[model samples]
Target chain A: MSAKKTEYGEDQDLLMKKSDRRTFLKGCSVAAAAASAALTSGCIPSVAAENSEEMKLRWQEFFKKNYRLMTQEEKDATVARLERLAKLRDGLDVQMGSYPPLKGVLYGYGFNITRCEGFMECVAACVKENNLDRKTNTQYIRIFEMEPGKLDPGTGDGQYYHKVPVENKFYMGTQCFHCENAPCTKACPTKATWREPDGIVVVDYDWCIGCRYCQAACPYYGRRFNWGKPEIPRQEINLRQHYLGNRVRPKGKMEKCTFCIQRTRKGRLPACVEACPTGARVFGNLLDPDSEIRYVLKHKKVFRMKEELGTDPKFWYFID
Target chain B: MQLFLTGLILLVGITTLFWGRARASESSFLDEVKKSTARFDNRSVPLVKEVTEDTVLSHEKYQGGSFRVLARKKNIERYQCSNCHNDKPVTVNRGAELTHGDIVLNHGSAERGLVCIDCHSPEQRDYLEDKKGRKIDFDHSYDLCGQCHFRQKRDWIGGAHGKRVVNWAGDRVVYNCTTCHDPHSPRFEKRFPATYSVPLD
Candidate 1:
C-alpha cells in the first residue's frame, strides 16, 4: 500500500501503540479547554456534545458475560480475575483494572414478551451503559419469531423482518436470562462465566479463552463470542467506566446480558428496560411481591423460555 | 414528497440492515390510489393490482406467484412478494436492506393510511454461510419493521417487544420488530393493538 496521508500528525505510528493514554489525555485536555473556553465564549464542547475521553474510550471498551451463573467461590475467583485485568487495560480511568473487590450486589428482571416489539433499543442502551465496542457490542440479545400463544421458545429469526410489524407472527428476544442453575457455568472448563450477587450474570472477560462451551451450554443462545477485536470509531466511545460489566471488553471475551448490573445494582434500570417504549419490560425486586415484576408474574400467564431443560432461568415471558 | 420519504426510508433501511437479521422480499401490493381504485377482490394478499378495504389482494393478482426477480444472487432466495400484501396499503422496498423494512405498520392506529411502503423496505436476503460453517449475516432482522413503528422499535430495543426474557439475575430483555409482525402484511399476532403494553392516550 502507498504511504497514506495522515490526519493524526507526525508520530501517528507512535500514537497508535499508546492510543489509550494519549487519547485519554487528549480528551481530558480538550474537555478542560472546552469548559474553560465555554466559560468565556460558549463555544466549547457542551455537556450534550460528545466527551472526547468517552469517545476515545469507545473502541477499547468491552462487557463481561453473565455473572449470575457463578457460585460464591468461583464468583470471588472471577472477581479476582477481573481485578488482575484492571491493572493492564488500556483506558483504565480510575485504575485500569486493580480496584475493589465485588461487594454485596443484587440482580433481577421481568419481561412481557407479549408486549415485546423487537426494536433492539435495549441492545444499544446496553452498549452505552457497558461501554461496549461499537463493532461487536458483545451482548447477545436476539429477537426471534414463533407461533403466538404457542411458545416454542427461541425458535424464530429474532432479527429478520421484511415488510415489518409481522402481525400474527410472534416476537421474542433471547438474552442471558440469568438462571438460578445456569448450565453455562457448569459446562465451563474454566470458571469464566459466573453469576454475580444481586442476580446479574457476568463473565471474567480477561479469563475467558474464547471457548464456545458456555455459548453452547446456554440453551437460551444468550452468550456471544468476539470473533475479532471490535471495530469502532474512537469518537463514538463511551467511557463512564465500570469494572465488571461493559467498560471496554477485549478481543475474545465470551459475553452476555448482565441485566445492566453496572446500572441496576446501583438502583438504575438496565438500558433495555428503560428504552422499551411499550413498557413490556417490568424491572423490580422479584423477591418483593409488591414490585411490578411480581404483578406481572401474578397477573400474566408467564413461562420461562425453556422448561424442559429446567435451567431455572430468572427471565420469564408473559402473555395477557 | 414521496422521494423525501424514500430518502428517509433509505437512511433508516441501511441502518436497519446492520441492526438486524438479514432479509425478506417485498411487493407493490399496497398503495393509496391503487387501494382506492382497486383491481383484485378478497382474501387479503400483498401485491394485487386492484384494491379494497376488506382484502388487500388475492392469488388472481399475479401469475408467476411469489417468485424471485431481482437478478438472483447465489444462495439468496426470494419469496412471493404479494403473499401477504394488497393494494389497500401499497408498500414496497426501495433498497436499504439494512433495515429490511417494506410496509407501513398501523400498530392499530385509526390514523394509519396507505403509504405502507413508507415504513417497509425491499427486504434484504442473504443465506450465505460463513467461514465458521455458520451464518454470518447481521442479526436483529426485525429492525427493518421498526423503522416506522418506532415506538415498538423503542420497546423492542429496551427488551420489551418480542420475548424479552431476562437473566436469572433479573429484568425482561427487549425485542425487535419481526418478533410480532410479518413484513409482507404487517399485522399483529393476536388482536387489535397487538401491543397493549404501549399507552393509549
Candidate 2:
C-alpha cells in the first residue's frame, strides 16, 4: 500500500481496537449495528406500556388516592414510600433533604397541579420550617393547575397551572424567578439584592441597607425583604449554613430561593426538588448545550413563565 | 554494527515522540476542547501561593462590594496553579480534593472541594468577581463548575431541589458546577450529618 493508504489502514485498525472496553467508545457504526440487532431481536426497552389499560388504571388510582396531611412519623414513612416509587419509575436512587432535629425544617411551598393532592404539605412545610410570621408563612412557591378543554389537550394546549392534582392536571412551581436581568437587582439602591453567578438572587443582611428594591422589582413577589429579624427561638436555629445562601438569615435582608445553593449547589438537590415525588421539576445550566435543562428545552415544547415581558427566565413550564 | 545502532536510536526517538502524544492525548484533547470553548488557549491557569498548594480551589473570599481584600491578601499570579493544570482535576495530579470540603483544614466531607469551581466562578455568590477583575470569560464559574461536578445536578428541578415536572426522565442531565455551588467555598453537600455521624440536626 502507498504511505497514505498504509496510515489510513492503521487508523482503521485503531478504530477497530476492541476488547471488553468497546462499551466506552463503540463508535457510530458499532453502536448502530448493536442497536439494530437489539431492535430486530426485540430487546429494546418498550415505548408503550405492556398493558396500557393497567397503566391507565394505576395512574387513575394514583390520582384518586388521597395524599393527606402527615405528621413527622407519617411524613418519614411517606418519604420512604416515595423513594421506592422513584426507583421503580426511573431506576435511580435518591434520598430526600431533611431538616435539623425539628420534625420540620426550612419552610417553602410549591403546588403541582397534576400530582398535588392539595393537603399542601409544602405550604405547611414552609410555615413550620420558615417560621413564617403565620400571617405570611407563605414564602414557598404555589402553582395552580388549570386547563382549557376547549383547546387541544394532549400537550401544548394549556395556558397556566392552577389547583394541581385535578384530573388531567399538570403542575408548575414558580418562585423567585431569579432572572439574569432581575428587576430586583436593578431597583436596589444600596446594591444589596444581587444575582449570584450561580443564578440565585440574594440579599446581604448586614449590607442590604434595608432597601426593598428587590421586593418591588420582583413580579412573582418571590423576593421577601425581611421587615425584622425573624423571631425564632435560638434553640430552633438551624446553624449549619452557608454565608449568602444559607445560615440563619438575619432580619431586614431579603431572601428567596437560592436554588437551594447551600444544598443543591453542593451535590445534593434542592429541598423542593427532592421533596417532589412526581418527577416534575427540572434544573440545569442554560449555557451548557448538552445539559439536561438544555435537553428539556431542546426536546419538549416548553414555555417560559412569561415570554412576552422579555425577562428571559431560565425557569420553564410544560404539560405531561 | 554502528549503522544498526544508529537505526535503533532513530526508531526509539520516533517511538517516544509518538508515545508522548499518545500517552498525553486524553488530557491534551480535553484541553483543546476547553480552549476552543473559551476561544482561549488558557494563556495559562495562574497559580498563587495561599493555602499551601495541595488544594485546587483558591479561597479568595469575597466581601463588601469588591474582591479588594481577597485580591490584596492573595498573590494569585505568583502562584496561579492553573498554569499547569488546564482542565483535569488537580487532586489527581496537581492538587488534591478537599476530602473535608475545606481548603485550609478538615471540617467534614461535604464541605471540601470535590470539584474546581467549588470556589472559582465568574461571579461569586456574593456577586463579586476576582480582585484582578471580572472581564476574562463566560460566567467565570459557569464553565469551571461543570468541569468537575458532573453528577450532582442530575436532580435539581424547577424552583425546587429535585426534578418534579420539566425533564427528570429519559437520560439523566447533569449541569455545571456553578449551576449549584459557589466556588469560593467548596461544599460537596449539606453536612449530611446522618450520612456520616449521627445527626446534630
Which candidate number maximizes lDDT?
1
lDDT of 2 by residue, B1-201 (tens): 999999999999999999975654333211321232221111121211122211122222211111111121132232333434355444433334423233443222666533333333333323323334442232333323323442323223222222422122212232223333334544333211110111110
DockQ values, each candidate: 0.01, 0.02
Misplaced by over 4 Å in model 2 are A1-135, A145-164, A168-170, A232-236, B1-201
Question: How much lDDT does candidate 1 score?
Answer: 0.49
Error of 1 at B82 (Å): 51
Q: Mind giving the per-residue lDDT tens digits that candidate 1 earns over B34-105? A: 233222221221211221112111111111121111111221234433343334554456545523454344
lDDT of 1 at A100: 25
RMSD of each: 26.9, 30.8
What would the per-residue lDDT of candidate 2 be over residues A201-261, giving only the tens digit for each residue?
6654534666667677777656665566555554553433444454344566777766654
- lDDT of all the models against the reference? 0.49, 0.41
